[model samples]
Target: MLSITTFILLGILGLFLYLLVKYPDKSIGTNERPDLVGPRGLPIIGNLIGIYLKGFTNFNYENLTKYGPNATSTSLGFGRLIAINDPECIEYVMKTNFENYIKPNLLKEALNDVLGDEKCGDSNENWRAIYLTQKIFVKLFEEDTKKLLNIMEAKVQSGETFDLQQLFFRFTLDTFLKITFGLDKNSFADPEEPVRFAMAFDSVQATIDGRFLNPFWKFTEIFSEGGRKMRANCKYLSEFAYKIIKKRRNDPKALKNPKDILNIFMNAKLEDGQYLTDKELRDIILNLIIAGRDTTAQTLSWMMYNVMVNPAIEQKMVNEINTLLSNEKPIPKYEDVKQFEFVQATLYETLRLHPSVPGSVKYCLGNDVLPNGTPVNAGELVIMSAWAMGRDERIWGADAKIFDPERFIKDKNGLKPSQYKFVSFNCGPRLCLGQNFATIEFMTLTTSLLRKYQFEIMPGQKSPPDFGNSVTLPMKDPLLVKVYRRN
Candidate 1:
């Protein structure tokens, strides 16, 4: 006679076996293209186990390199994924046949909670109309940079090691909030509201990344502790966004200024001649926050890490900034930043090695052949590995792994690479509208800091920090550094 516990255990094992047998490998159907090459997958589960163990960025780069210089195909249990690293293929998919590929429904569903159902909007007009001028950008961010420098000065005076990455995240969040909604979040001071909002924002982003790996995340989210936390975080973040929207709607003063990005959206008319709904405003604001905050912060963090690790590179950057501007005029004007060729080159190099959005996925709306002759079927996924492309020896050079800013500097001006090749800002029609703004911000902040302070990586810290698994390429560990005042 079996005991109750024994019976339950046996039944659970039987159910697991039943699922394995009942579900056929989804990627093994007629849609599987034999010409494409990749790692062999196991029964039912496919390469998900491998991806889980190896990490997303590493797994994609390793397999894509081994199986292809152009493209490779694999399955992640749910469906077939064709990973493309070739520039020509990327251009074809992102540009020539852009209409045929769209954000995957699975991805949209995962992100919909935080980002709302808003596709990229026509932001160029808004940017041009209000904030494109050099003076506006300098005016908008100068005070924020000063605040940041003051905080770093405090750290320097304390003679304590700190995580620059965390500081950068907070700094960018404050600056972006100020520009986007005309609200000074003061994240540098680490107030309760802004800190809590930042934590919730980051937690929700990590949860969304997890969703991409697990097909039955909906069910898991109900029963798991992590899922419950994710739900709570999402709720908090939503409330935060809506609260801002409600406050802005009532503030007639907000309309008169026309300084922030929110006012532009709020006042604009749609095709239907109606003002944006509160929900639309929430979506746009949240999306912009994620874009403006994470990308800039993470890139700055990585750039600093790279500069610290390479002393020669750091010296060159310091000399360039110092020569261009002095303590008398420390904070760079937007035009002054344009002249700091070495600083700009360093930024481009950092982005090439550690793109903020390391990779992007597009769903094929119809069957099509890529420029590289890779056949992608409708319902399949095209995974463009920006990280892989950046590191690829064929695309860059034999010394692609080495950090070199000279690659971007030609005759003392920034060399413009093909959008497909240097795709940190993305390529084609969907090129980031904030490209100019982000560049100016990067150069401005970087020039300002290097002018006054020097950085050293804390002892025993890992060389070339490991990348975290997130929508953006964040350092896995806090980028701890010892700050020093420049003589």
Candidate 2:
């Protein structure tokens, strides 16, 4: 005989079984997803949850290797990830149909404060601002570059183990400050005290990178520790940027004639004859400083490291520079740099292996098919890996992973990867505006340093490049090396 309690327990068990059959798992199961093959995860939650946790660099390599380098795409619970490594597909996305695939909202949220809206600046005003900014950097590169070399000489005098990456950062940052805002903060000379604003600027970027991992990151905007750091960083950097802008605005000489990029924007007027606002000028100069500084520094650090690892390459590069240097000056003249084939190739090989900007991310605007027949739906994030392509055996031959600069120089058949194939500065209309300026800066610094000194990677340093998570590719660990003055 069943008691009332017994009857109730039986009834509950029956209902639970009924519901299980009534509503089975509704998630898009393994191998049942739409034409996309990638890492597996919980149903409807996306296979990319773990990948995002790892990082974009890891996220790209895993997908490309699994789905074949020709093309790949996946849904990351929140948004879709579409990645392709083939040059034809890359050209299609970056060049042929550039207007459609723009920087998605998520990316903008991460970088808008630092990079600004004019990365692909197409308007007349944007063009003029880029033109004026380029002009200023080129004109000032010589003198400011000399200042940087002087600081490196001081480091040699001390002869203590030092961070090469930090020195590069100070050199580039100092150059940007003096060239754009006409402010000189000798950061390299005094490495004991770090700059507050620069520290904040870096913190903001790391937090922003965190946002990309979570699709529902907005929920934590005010709650999480990362969000708190981001808010503080934004406030601090904005204050610092605005202070510089306002100081330049009130200066009398700024209006009479342009002395820097800030002066150009301050004096600039449209056909109606009114100067750009303080906010507009501030964003522009800030964008230039943010975009231009870290990249050149990263490239220089990587190039120096590669030279250390490959002594033969270093001697070849030094010999080329020795032959090219003008008798009057100790360093190669500015125009003579382009003539150094091996020197240029060394830089190229360095970029190929360790691109400053490793990958490209764009949002698909419509249902499109890649050259490789991978279907990309609207609203999916289209990611392409320059890092993977730089190492792909199919594209670059069996020795693709070798650090050989001759691959870039005149080959046996005069064969070389096109800019579209090997894109460190990006390609098409959205191509890096500072490419020429960056190249000139890179070559000038490399020649100057090589002519005067040799860098030896300190013993006990990590071998496979340890990289940090940032918009720019910075070494994960500070590059510690000893510098010797060349005879």
Candidate that scores best on lDDT: 1
lDDT of each: 0.81, 0.73
- Return the top candidate by TM-score: 1
Tens-digit per-residue lDDT, 169-216, candidate 2:
877888778767778777766776797757876777677667667666
Candidate 2 Cα misplacement greater than 4 A, ranges: 1-34, 70-77, 119-139, 269-275, 326-328, 411-417
| TM-score of every candidate | 0.92, 0.87
Give per-residue CA lDDT, model 1, range 127-219, as digits (tens): 565454436646767888898889889888999888898888888888888877788877777522348878888888888888877778889
TM-score of 2: 0.87
Query: Candidate 2's C-alpha lDDT?
Result: 0.73
